[model samples]
Target: MPSGAVRMSRKRAPEPASQLGDVPERKRVSWGILISQGSWADRSPLHEAASQGRLLALRTLLAQVTPVTKGCHANIATIDHVTPLHEACLSGHVACVRALISAGANVNAATFDGITPLYNCCSSGSVGCLELLLQNGAHTRARHAHLPSALHEACKRGNSQCVESLLAHGADPDLKVPQLGSPLYVSCLHRHADCSKILLHTGANVNVGRGNDSPLHAAVRQDSRDQVTLLLDYGANVNSRDEDGRRPLELAPPGGPSQQLLVSFQGSPRTLCQLCRLRIRNVIGRSRLKHLPRLPLPPLLTQYLEHM
Candidate 1:
């Protein structure tokens, strides 16, 4: 198969461990049975153990297997190219993940669908597994060709902890997928206010999105008043229009909170203080906004600068 290509195997229910063959009663077993029988199965025993978070079984398998580089079974993939590492990360089994990585599993291995172990960790909201992958050199920016970035996946799932972990590890919040636009856009679409806040605080481009659909546009479409307020606080352009030429206020449903809030903003001019705060935040840039608390200012003034 071509690199990173996934091939679907014939559908078959997972077989029980009893049918795989008997082994000597010990903590660790030989790889001969796993290699002989699992090669033709949908997944290897290692994959099953990792996916189920069977730490002891995983460790025993790892101990018995030779180095992956020597054609050992550590990095074995299923018919669909899903590795044990992928299984472990997908299931949020940190111990199995660490064991797989220690046994020389490829941390950045991509499956047929282009989903990397790091991406699976984010999709599963496994912050521990995600961090373990990053610490072991998983590519933070690895894309699945068709799927969104790891940051986008975390935001899509409304996983603020995963979002924070990805950002702290240098994942780009603005990295646009073909249809997903920016992570902020996805967060707003899902009404994940906390994720949106984190993305904005981390310097994501508030105006970036698919076509003309800015984060503000998405927030309004979702009718999330809190998200709209948060976006406005972070300097999102209230007058920004979508692809259909409808501004955020125009997109708001009639008589809804979003509409009410938007109408109010439209009727009343922004305060000079609010405008100045927005200007300062814009000038300082999103990446540097976090440092506002350390500036030589009073606590109240610093809170204002941080938009607290």
Candidate 2:
């Protein structure tokens, strides 16, 4: 009608009834349109943006979605039951994860493979993302039998900061998975001395571990003097036997330093100071152990109790 306006003519608007077959997903996502969660793996543009750490695109897509679907897109699961939050967390995209979470994504959404966003964040060692999920009420512990514990994932990955965050948030330090054993055991098994030390400091039972195997046994097998010393300091049971009826000393390589340390520990006693430290920590309670410095005790005594 207008001189500057160009009219586009469609020769055919409609064909036969239901004769065009199924439309390609891209057909629905034509130019200038932003759509998400199609019929295939159920992945949306949001999932793509979140997974690739495209923060700008992710925000833009969220902006284009309708009000009802804006927050929902952050939560829609793929065929694998993986949300965009999962993708962003797994990829360690803090800003994207924050965006998804701010858009009302469920912080505790678990995948078909028993992974929560917290678990993925810990696995990726992104403390920022981990903090975001935790602040959003992500379960510090797995709520379902199918969901793996985020603390265990952190320990297995040797992420002490993540482990500490989970612990500080009330995660069970001694949670024992049937296949993975205790967090302490997995940390020792993986040679994560720092993680094990943190677990020990947080009052994890030194002698408890995966069925019949002690953290000491894991440390002995690893032949790590640091692990052995740390466990010994925490009063790990040297005489503890595994399923194979073997002691930690037996697991160490013959004539190795760990074996020699175990030999000395077998016949000797822990110092009065070490015993007192352990007793004080136990009496202080795990929940209150973090406040040891504020108890008006001597700073040196407090540091000793906290293993500082």
Name the best candidate (by lDDT). Answer: 2
Question: Which lDDT values do the candidates have, in the order given?
Answer: 0.77, 0.80
Off by more than 4 A, model 2: 1-41
lDDT of candidate 2 vs native? 0.80
lDDT of 1 by residue, 1-308 (tens): 23533222112343457854453221112122223333445678988898789999988887885554432577888776778898787668898888888788888877665668887777778899998988989888864545646787788878899999989878888888887888899999999999998888777878887778999888888999999898877667787878888898888888888898888877887798988987888898757776787788899988777667
For each candidate in turn, the TM-score is: 0.83, 0.84
Model 1 residue 299 distance off true place after TM-score fit, in angstroms = 3.3
Positional deviation of residue 248's Cα in model 1 after best superposition, in angstroms: 1.6
Q: Across residues 116-153, which tens digit of lDDT does each residue of candidate 2 receive?
A: 88987877788999999888899887776535778887
Pairs with backbone N, CA or C atoms under 3 Å apart (clashes), candidate 2: 37-44
Model 1 scores worst on lDDT over the 10 consecutive residues at 24-33
